[model samples]
Target: MKTTAAPGSPAGLLVLWTLTRTALLLCVLKVIVFPGPDVTSDVSVIYRGWYDVLSAGTFPQDDVTWQYPPAAALAILSPGLLPFLGYATAFFVLALVADLVTLALLLYAGRGPGRARRGAWVWVAGVPLLGPTVYARYDVMVTAVAVAALLAGVRHPRVMGALVGFGALLKVWPALLLVGVRRRGAWVSAVVTGAGVAVLFAVLMPGAFAFLTFQKDRGTEVESLGALVFHVARHHGWEGEVLLNYGSVEFLGPYVNWVSTGALFLTGAALVWLVVWRALARRLEPHTVADAAFVGVLLFTTTSRVISPQYMVWLVGLAAVCLCFRDSRMGAPVVLVLGACLVTVLEFPVWFAHVVASDALGVSLLVVRNGLLVAAAVLGGRRLWHATVPGWRGVAGVPGPAPAAETPVAP
Candidate 1:
């Protein structure tokens, strides 16, 4: 039997054409007409400071050292030569290009699905009222490498492992790629590449390795699990004390000390167990890597002590990859992430000015932003029901095309 789905009507096609033209025009206007003031902060400040350090022949920590791994500074300082865009604009455009690369990698990986899946990246670029595309951050470069690494994982597992190991040096999140990858050869490759990158890094800055070794001494954080406990304690007015419970160290907020390590360990254990479940069940599919990575990133953002806006760049780039998923159900997470980003842009750019001026309006936007992310999680989890292990997994003793945990999810 043959089924013929009707082609999109002329009217529908016309609407899409009109929207694309409007989006592109708006993008140009955004770039030319509204040359925004440099009001953004975080890695913007970090990157500029790094440039000064480089020009002065001093490593970052010697002056105003930020917490990122050393290789991240190389990425941050890359746009220095483009005087016209300023370090900021050049960095911004490069970030957008990186996102395009992520989109391409996603499309290439999912090409087996069909054209509609591949063409979805085009529609994603047209999603109107999206957040500002340019923000200064290393997330873009790392994300570009990370997405490329994911594609390479399927085609060139050894290279993928190497890329991820290097990317992990830039930002710790890339380490998660090791979970979904099952090959023993890839693991050895990752260890070898990571060691080589580490050796080069050592030569670059004689003391960097020592700094990294003591990296854990930096500080827990106000935004993290044990810190949150301290925050609630302070509000109620209690004596705060620090304790190491079963390997996890914690501190109370504001004071930065006095937390139960035991509680932290328990909480961490639960989260780690959940991650293992997601991995063991093959819940995070290769085609859904973009979606899963966003969830992983948000897990870091929402749970970690810092909520830097530039971090949004990482998730947004991955969102582009998820949108490239041919499955509509798989693509829903992209829509949620898109909404969250627009709110992120609105929240800042003026530092709570719009929010505090009209509290309800600001709160509404925040609610919408988090709500959409929550929805994306639901859609992504549902993918567990439909995902089928590839033939390659058969060699690894994983079943082929097994029935999903439930029915096919509507992406």
Candidate 2:
């Protein structure tokens, strides 16, 4: 036996987590300034403003930037939990706590029979790659809830459903976590819980569902896959102007709406593919839910009209949960998502000015980052379909032996 600690030993992993998270906190706290734009301004300025409005007992109905679900107000108001600290400082502290909770959940899940600690390692490494932006946004807190929901999916599906419902209200993407769930209880619980939350918010808060109409006139965000069209067009006399619209930098004018519409069509096609996959799937393993969720989010994220840097946090969390199971075949997609995360940080806050200019550096970063996402979506979706659907290995135009009947795992 060696005297030195192994790389993934519990103590070593904790040490690494502590070091990286400490650096993240320092950057968010302004003790060490992160290069590029001030990522914390959202917390210090926008979130604080929202906090005041929420405390007044109504949503930010008039603000076009308030494009999130009603439950998102809770996240904005959460800094009130630590009144001794300033608003931004409290938000950062709570973000750190959420990050810690996510890590603990991954570590616990990784200790199960046939599970490995690679998922915990993934969480430890992936977050910091996006820099202080992780702490500046409420997305990390939402991710903690999503991580818990996925890890609890097999044994405690009702719990998973309830959490996913609450998480969806928080941001809306968490609803995709239910794509692979086969149990009736999970679906029933999700519907009841989501309805209850929506009704409660609607009754008590004015304009609770106003977020629905906020994106009607939204254009293609400069960071999205479709925005690459305009980035290239700008060089060849595409006259669209980049402007701060509806809380994100987007290309507006010319054929921007057409590109945005194309993105929506791609999203609809992804939904159709998922429906087909679900219908044909004949097997379900312990890791299958996580794998399907990872693939589902990948497809939607890559095809969306906006692929904000913080969106990587959601993918990282789902990817971590997938890796907790030794049987999960999402390894290649996980690596690609990690690569995208690294590129995301470079494109935003580091050399973000270059990206906005549609110059060589910014355009190159978008190409690499978005390219990685597209590749991951395709590969991960294919792997998920092959793993769950029987007869995937049959030769083209030649029939193969029937698949043996197998009992599906109880959800």
Candidate 3:
């Protein structure tokens, strides 16, 4: 008997993806002016500038804003593949292609036995929720590689490792994707691939590693969890100024360094917790990898000195991967991440001026967005602990298996 497909069936998802993506492309291309600042300027101005420098066979050696790793040059130069189209237009088109590739991967994963289509819906809905910023930044392309890596990890650990190595060079966050992976081959492949790429770039390009030095002086961005201190302090005459530092708007005055240090400390603490979880986890499953990766990224992101709106792309992509598994216990955290994504757009390009000014509306939005992220991180960590660690009740208070009873044997 033929059963009618649900509204979120693969075909329906493809249609919705097409419609929403068209809207995003329109906004990015400037045919439809999105509310707030022109987000596409990054691609047209900053990225194009870097592309010019990279094309000259060198990194942007003198530009402080050239903060990305060497592999980012590929994304900047990718627009050259469609030289007939202008750089900005070609970039947007390529971003859409990356988006499509991610969707295709999710759809294919969802059709496997025991997998669900909820992940596809999450990707389709979550990307548009962040507005045109998804396509305006190169984060979406990096996210596509991440989504592919997670989907492949269950069956192709080597492939997952190689992609993770490449994606990490594109942007550093994808390295977190390996937090939950237990395969030795994946680790070996990641080390080999990463070292190989690092060596190749070092040999071919001068200043390939200059981005490391550029990060040492970064201040807390206006949208970070620590930035709330400054936002509230502004009303209390705390005598600090928000300024564009590095490539982001950051709090640049009194005690800003202290807050940035605190954020780094929190990040260190998050690492300790993950290391503990790895040592204690006994119930490793296929889905546990995605769940742990989601939790790990959430912890680091929530504790980071800069919580840019585009960072939400990484969370959304990881959250979607978690939902692909029927046994995954990240449903609540995924919901919180989606809510955060919605609020991120509001705090960013929509009311970014208010955020920069540290006004009440901006403060409220930051509280909500950062609060959701914090809640998700805590809840996700607890859920992952219960589901994997022995002697704790799993999700929904279901008791985990007790240790096997020792049987007496005749000696």
lDDT per residue as tens, model 3, 66-90: 8988888899999999999999999
User: What's the CA error at residue 49 for candidate 1, in Å?
Assistant: 2.7
Arrange candidates, best TM-score first: 2, 3, 1
Model 1 per-residue lDDT at 271: 57
Model 2 global lDDT (CA atoms, 0 to 1)? 0.91
Q: Once model 3 is optimally superposed onto the true structure by TM-score, how far is the C-alpha of residue 298 displaced, in angstroms? A: 0.9
Q: Rank the candidates by lDDT, best first.
A: 2, 3, 1
Clashes of each: 10, 0, 0
Regions of model 3 farther than 4 Å from truth: 1-6, 395-411
Alpha-carbon error at 309 in model 2, in Å?
0.4
- lDDT tens readout by residue for model 2, 217-316: 9999999999999999999998779999999999999998899999999999999999999988876778889999999999999999999999999999
* Candidate 1 lDDT over residue span 97-183, tens digit each: 665565456555555653244333433342333334343445767877877776676557788788878888788778766654556
What's the lDDT of the predicted structure labeled candidate 1? 0.52
Which regions in candidate 1 have their CA more than 4 angstroms from the true location? 1-37, 40-45, 55-58, 63-65, 80-86, 103-130, 207-271, 282-294, 327-329, 354-361, 385-411
Clashing pairs in 2: none
Candidate 2 has what TM-score? 0.96
